[model samples]
Target: MSYQSIHIQIKEMIFSKDVSIVEFQFWLAEVETFLCQQQNFVLVVRSVAGTTFPQEYRQIQANWYKKNKANFFKYCVGLVRIALDQVDQERLNTPALHVAWQVPYYVTLDRADALQWAVQRWLLCNA
Candidate 1:
């Protein structure tokens, strides 16, 4: 399947679902490349119904990270969008990593009053 055709889930960052173990590794690898190639961006990933990495795909990622640590940046935002009918706990528990070369300075907009809380921060501060 074409990456262009794929739509990842996005709340803040964009994300996609992994249907299987092989697909899960492929997804991570692709995301890693996207972050390395892009200068500034946020990645959105929804934790799957199972522990994708820790239980199934972590070793693959570990090997990749071991060799390309410099090419990627790890940010643990600890963000989770929960749903009752869905959302697997084991999958959520699996460690999630967001790779980015740079982070942007921004303000938090209140969900109820977006503009009221929205304010842009200086990028220099982030750097």
Candidate 2:
């Protein structure tokens, strides 16, 4: 699947809302350049919001993320403030560890905190 390139200025870490796998793929294609060129990254998902992806699809993507864990150095995660169903929370919580349970990483339930944490960490990483 192909998606129109989404342009986002990530000079400072910021929270991104739910995006599809193809859009995620497109975003990653963009992020790879940053990861290779910059210090680190912190990406946040506000919530599932909506999706056409099946459960298996998300699981597969999450699995790929888990396998490529080492590809990340500067990354963190934040969940949305909106309420989520049990299944959605489970899905988010599981892959979130790819961000949460790590060295020099953190998980914030609030978007503002997550962005602040990510920016601080990025500054520290560069310093």
Candidate 3:
């Protein structure tokens, strides 16, 4: 399934374009729905090299994550974020932000590394 700038696969979400607030909300809803199934999954978010969002979008995501913290902990094994652009790579490399996610979070410029990290987490969780 797919929203405006987000494409959803069984265990991955690809953000191929810059997302608007509406699109972000849609993606959030899809995530919430997925969590409702109560299954363990690794979420791999691949953002296009230059994709970015406004501060408001971050605020919305923060609020939603806060509200669903427990469900996320129970269902999400980890999160792997692939950001190819230098700016995005630096921004996502923060230790504090990684801790704030409350899940294993990894950021990398290489999609292969992201997938490998995600698969490792998935294996650990499902083991």
Judging by TM-score against the true structure, name the best candidate. 3
**Per-candidate local distance difference test:** 0.38, 0.48, 0.79
Clash count, candidate 1? 5
Index of the highest-lDDT prediction: 3
lDDT (tens digit, per residue) of candidate 1 on 1-127: 5554422212243234435677766666665665565433233334323433436566776777667555544431122323222234343333331122232222222222222212112122224
Model with the higher TM-score, candidate 1 or 2: 2
Candidate numbers, best TM-score first, in rank order: 3, 2, 1
114: Cα error in model 3, Å: 1.1
List of clashing residue pairs for candidate 2:
41-74
* 1 against 2, candidate with superior lDDT: 2
TM-score each candidate.
0.40, 0.51, 0.80
Q: Give candidate 2 misplaced runs (Cα > 4 Å).
A: 1-20, 51-56, 59-68, 74-103
RMSD of 2: 9.1
50: Cα error in model 3, Å:
3.1
Q: Which pairs clash (backbone N, Cα, C closer than 3 Å) in model 3?
A: none
